[model samples]
Target: MQQAAPSASLPERARGVIPGGVNSGQRNVPGLTDLVITRAQGASFWDSDGRRYTDYHAAFGPPLLGHNDPDVVRAVAEAGGSLDLCGVGVTEGEVELAETLVELVPSMERVLLTSTGSEATFHALRVARAATGRRLVVKFQGCYHGWHDSVSLNVISAPDRVGHKDPISTGILPEVLDATLVLPFNDRDAVRAAFAEHGADIAAVILEPVPHNVGCLLPDQEFLVTLREECTRHGSVLVFDEVITGVRHGLGGWQEVAGIVPDLTTMGKAIANGYPIGAIGGRADLMDMFSSRPGAPVFFAGTYNGHPAVVAAALATLRKLHAEPVHEHVFRLGERVRTELPPVLASLGVPAVVTGYGSVFVTYFMDRLPHTYDDLLDNDTRMFVGYRRRMIDQGVFELPLNLKRSHFSYAHTDADVDRLIEVTEAAVRAQLADEGPLTDMDGTSTMGGATRC
Candidate 1:
């Protein structure tokens, strides 16, 4: 191993070993990653430079109760004293967490825990394939399930590749790409056509019910119902990839809110409130493939699938959620942002649409809001990135990337939201003054020949 220079900056040192000086591609924000975070508590994080910023990124939506939440911290600490990985058998914490998930998530009758959302989705697809004895999977273009090769393609693809197979990374086999069918979100006819053409081959239809990865493209209820009906008719498993939407939206997830149930649901991000935990849950018959029986086909094995401290943290987070009005507070603040931010931008001649549900938001530089990824093609990518970058400069931490949604935590208050709005106005004003001519005839500066970065 090599060592960084004693005086070298954190990012400078990190780029030497870590790819792009970040672990995840989403964390590779141009300006935001330059500084290393020192610590975070409540609704803000402090950088190594000793500057505090009100956080809207929320560690990509994991810190729903906010960074280093006291309740979660105490629970983890307590668990650490008495409980560690035993590996041979299950712990009480894991069982309780699973029980809590089954009780809360409307669709989950049985549950399996994994260490990350990627693993949960991987297990989910595997379970679906094993259950249906099918190879092909159907995913919406903008909804990102995870990094596994099966569903890696077609998220935030370039304009030319909008409706085609465009893998985010190399090394994914062409056959793997071919096995997954990607379609436009909120397009009921497209979904129906795909089902009509190849429903029998599709093992599962997986999507983020709200499609938060490409900024919230709210699902049409009819489109969801269509998927449910089609998958039922075809014997294909219907999966809701709720990794981003899981406990953040509600205890029952978006499925409960939408009154639409899926055969399988993958959860993470906010489930444990910043702990390293992920879960896959669904129908008992389907999940039984991983049962510890003499002839169970699916292989379900993990050394640290449900680490005690992590499960304890999750249980504590849920307790706080049940005891406090977390959803009510965050939802009200989120609604305030959605209602207040747009008109403020419009007044500044910055034609933008703020889109999200509950505690997430994204300011799209477009006239009308989007219903599908195709509708987002015309969004001003340059301006979208620029505005977020500007917000970061002004001490409001919006991820400086196009199409990424901002997350509000339970720690955020009315004052924090007020600061966000004030900084947002300043950010837009600064961008318009610097860039010049930010609007087009249709009220959005089009991306126009530029690729999504």
Candidate 2:
């Protein structure tokens, strides 16, 4: 795990050309030198200097079967050679992909293909508003739906800013901000209150059934049940934003795990096994809003919506996931991660909480697992961020920050999990030994030994 800064000139080169030296705002962890990864394969990727990392980033949760999975790659290549984009009528691949989704998802009576999860989610909200004739959307705080105007408020805000309509991005209109009502996750009482106040005017209640965005905070059964009951009682569409969790749990996604059907579901990430694709599916009557027969039809069209190569990749990905015990394997790996890491932290006197479900997990800097966004405010995030950088230097690709989830794919072997625990222990010990006199993960002062990343 000898370290080298990634091609030292790359960051300067990128900043000269790209905004913030990156396309996505979150391309770099806070304290690390910016990197340019050169190649990726199963369960690992390499930086510009040929340093290989056991990748848990999973391309931010798309590569469930891991990078360059043979079947998905083959499907994409074959389709690219034959027909990649047919800008005419539908192809069998698209139709077959949709059919596969509908068959797998219990509530997918109808389906729409889109280029990204953001598009799928936007259209889902559109369909909900169109069908219900309501404009208000109820979303949980810290639950990120997408980059669209409607769903972009209150994502990972500071402690005092909870429930405030502070758009995380600039240029979001006041009206768009006004249309969204934010609440804390796992708060059934707040759900009740919001619905009681604005149920009649609410178009949809959207959230990740298990929120991966904020360190994998889970929905209490009561919380989820209340959402379902209230959405049903109020005629509001329940939209599950399963962009990260979709199909990572199973063939049918988190909805299958929860056993509660959302009125509409937006899916991406693991849906295509790293291919660029998205899908929105739900009840037939509501899904029909996109049809031409409607007088004011929801205009859901994208030239690349059903791109053949990506669709073929998605179909092949689904085929592999369905025909194999992918989830079982990954779930066990996830369990191994959650189970194994804490002892190392405890033995080294680092206070931390490890929480996750299925294949998505996070190592929080807090002493206990957090229940709300505000609770995360006091966490010694500086410590965890440094630990993650050390882990990267040890050739592991956990994102070097708090609040970002670590994704384990089916390609992660038993050896990978063992290596993960080993490196994490080494990283924590090294981090602790380098700096002196800082707070433990419990928010109490301790003799520290680590320098900042």
User: Per-residue lDDT for 54-110 in model 1, tens only?
Assistant: 999887898889999999999999999998998877788888999999999989999
Most accurate candidate by TM-score = 1
Model 1: clashing residue pairs? none
Error of 2 at 218 (Å): 1.1
TM-score of predicted structure 1: 0.95
CA lDDT of each prediction against the hidden true structure: 0.86, 0.82
Residue-level error in angstroms, candidate 1, position 240? 0.5
Q: Give lDDT tens digits, candidate 2, residues 1-453.
A: 544457748777777677778888667455444677889999999888888999998777899999999999998899988896668788999889889989998889988888999898999989899999998998887788889998887776655566577677889888888998988889999999999999999999999888777668877888889999999999999999888878887777788888988999999856889788899999999888796335648777888888988898899899999898998999999998899888878888877888888888888766788787776665666676667878887898888645778988878999999999998888888887876544433444532222111
